[model samples]
Target chain A: MRVSAPVRATVQRLTLPFLIFMSALLAVLGKADVLLFDRVRVVLADVLAPVLQVAGEPIASVSRAVGTVENVITVYHQNQELKLENQRLLQWQEVARRLQSENEELRNLVKFAPQGAVSSVAAQVIADSGGAFLHNILVNVGSREGVARGQPAMTGDGLVGRVIEVGGRTARILLLTDINSHIPVAIEGTHDHAMLNGDNSDEPRLVYVQPKTPVKSGDRIVTSGSGGMFPPDLPVGVVASVGGVIRVETYADLARLEMVRIVNYGLDGILPDGWVPTPQAGRRSHARAASSP
Target chain B: MPYSRNRDYVGFVARMVPGTTTFLFTLLSLLPFPVPSFGSIAPSFALMAVFHWTVYRPDLLPPGAVFVAGLLLDLLNGTPYVGLSALALLLVRTAVLNQRRIFSHRPFSVLWLGFFGATAGAFALEWAFVSLMQVEFLAPRPFVFQTLITAACFPIGSYVLALAHRAMPALSA
Candidate 1:
């Protein structure tokens, strides 16, 4: 096992380049036709699935316990808090009722309401890339569960991220806070469109906004859904001034993210003139037709 | 003859373990855990691990392995290219290797300073490359905080790595 000095030096010299070459090869191969690598990535993820499940279980238990404790604490203030919250919710409920009726009336008037349907599944976070330079999470869902690449994922709070790589029983989510993540968003107050760009830092930057547009701190941001990648009007975060830069303080707390819902909204066929199957209609089609002939 | 052979086997295992540990440490650092709205910066756990091993067990952990670890990190994290981290890690290893004599005799304060200096260099390199790529305003504060957090984790990581070194009879030689 005692290596000669020359052998040791040679080994040292070769190591870095070899690793670099392998990494480059992996990156290049990963980019070739998402479908090809998508399958491979899935298989690899499946192999890693058990690891994620084991890692995630303890975190999930802790989070659930924390949630239970918070619920119990809130119960002490429940009466007073609920009174105030109930007043606010009642106002919202009235508005919601009106909106529901109005939306129904509008849909009937339009005659041809786009009959798009959506299906959803739940997934657990297995592992997280928690560093200053990357923001991705491995989830325990894959192509087996009909989870596809580009599917939008969210927490109960708001937009968490989207699935970028799906494996057989696992998928990697590119968090909205990742440096490489960019989503089209709009300001709730001003209706100004901008791109929410993740810079490997927590607070995402609001880019592509007009200089003259009035955007202020505390302004809410939501997905504009212009690309049809995500549903429209999903709450993103509030605009907060960090130093002088306006940044979104996302609603979903990533630190405590344990479970997430993977929305099955088909973005591909939802756009004009596409033929993607809608979940609800597809499900109903299997049942007896109401009226024939 | 058997005793000498056993010693060689122990030394080989000692040398190899650090490489595997370096890889595992890099993977742990790259785990996608999101920090609060400090911006996208998470703590540099891998950097801390590398710094610890290089400071205490240079024979076990080599410069080339450090570079590879950095490249692996870049790939796993889905960064722009390989050289960004490789270059930073190379610089850190070079600095650590060169100053090993001064650090070996000095107290913990000097070792801490060396770590700070190395981290500063690595952070500056990362920030500069990221900025050059036209992503300046994402969240500089988080990175700053992350650097501070990483620096804080150093002494503990160094202590643990030191313990690991002591546990292995071969590395002590």
Candidate 2:
């Protein structure tokens, strides 16, 4: 059947306005994380993640090649830097040895019971968050590999993010540079606790510190583990700039995140004994737990 | 345009090629390759596709596919608001769909310029939506860079899309 001109034009006019309304509703629902939409998103991600994994294969090797090229270009300067770093490391090694023995003896005398062994699953970065609004990465490991919500994901350098959504074969990590990311952290020298809040910029600000807190540039920051989301004393980063506005340079380079480890330090308070009857409830509880100071 | 009853299977598949190719290109952009700071500023290939197909062949790359493409991107990249990209694309589609006459007849440079303006508008909408959703003003530098880079990459997307569009008739039947 042939369509009439006026009717077709009316429908065409209605299309844009209708789509605009639906798009707004979707944005609201998605940001609010309405149950139905989030479930579909998670399921879709799980289904589509393998395509990402396959697409990511070339990325790893290409990055590795680029790394080798850079290494070769800077080998001489790197050697000189390493020579000086080696001497400093040697001095620190002796101090660490003494501290370790003393701590072990003190622990033995006090009969300290060490917790269970920390286990971690290694995963490849399959995809990067392409937009400016969110800084996230998709890893190949997921709930099937025992990864769960609120688990701290790290690289060899330091913390990369925390697992927010986990499917059977994939998980989404919320990077510390994301606007929504707020991590509880402590300055090394001052030992003052603060929050590492991401503002969608490279350097996340350190907030919630007392005015008298003696924080300085180059002072290290580590996970405070106050909220039970992460274990105590995980090295996060060093204070890149401290005066005026405190900023931390994360150890893990968000730009070149290749491999990640979802650490299972048995610190996940949301899912007690790996019991998640429903994913939405588990995620909600984790959010509630995360909000408490 | 609605899928007419007279349209053949081959015609339907041919119509879908542009959207599918754009979806794949968008997927390609998500890989974290070791480029110097390019990962954060990688161009929006999907936007380029939407803009291109909107100007040339809205019947093939319709609003519904554009919306789905945006949502697919959201799910893939794990954005906070899933429909922000969709809204941006829909707005871009609307913006271009009305002015397709001038764009369709303009020279290549003018087309590129048009893409730049549309991308700027779309990204502004996305950035505003995100800041409103989070209740804070997000830094504009990233989106600004993304818009520039995407416009610069427009020629490449257009070139490839032209090839796909040109090559479809041969494969359709």
Question: Which regions of candidate 1 deviate over 4 angstroms?
Answer: A1-49, A52-75, A78-114, A187-193, A199-202, A207-220, A238-247, A254-256, A269-293, B1-16, B31-39, B135-139, B170-173
lDDT of 2 by residue, A1-293 (tens): 77999999998778778888888888877644445555676787788788877877777778778789999999999999999999999999999999999999999999999988899999988878877766888888888999988899999989987887888888888889887677778777666777888877888998777577667888899988776778878889988997788999999888777789999987754435332223244345445444654
Candidate 1 RMSD to the real structure: 8.9
TM-score of chain A, model number 1: 0.74
Q: Sum up the clashes in candidate 2.
A: 0
TM-score of each: 0.73, 0.87
CA error at residue A276 for candidate 1, angstroms: 24
**DockQ score of each predicted structure, in the order shown:** 0.27, 0.50
For model 2, state the Cα shift of residue A184 in Å: 0.7
C-alpha lDDT score of every prediction, in listed order? 0.68, 0.81
lDDT of 1 at A201: 56
**Per-candidate iRMSD:** 7.0, 3.9
Per-residue lDDT of candidate 1, residues A1-293 (tens digit)? 89999999898788655655554454334333334434444565577568546644655677678779988888868888889999999999999999999998998898856747888889876666655565777787888899877788888889988777766888778888776677778889677777787655567887767577867888899987666667778888998874566688899986657679998877752223221112232223222111110
Task: List, in order, the clash count of every candidate structure.
Answer: 21, 0
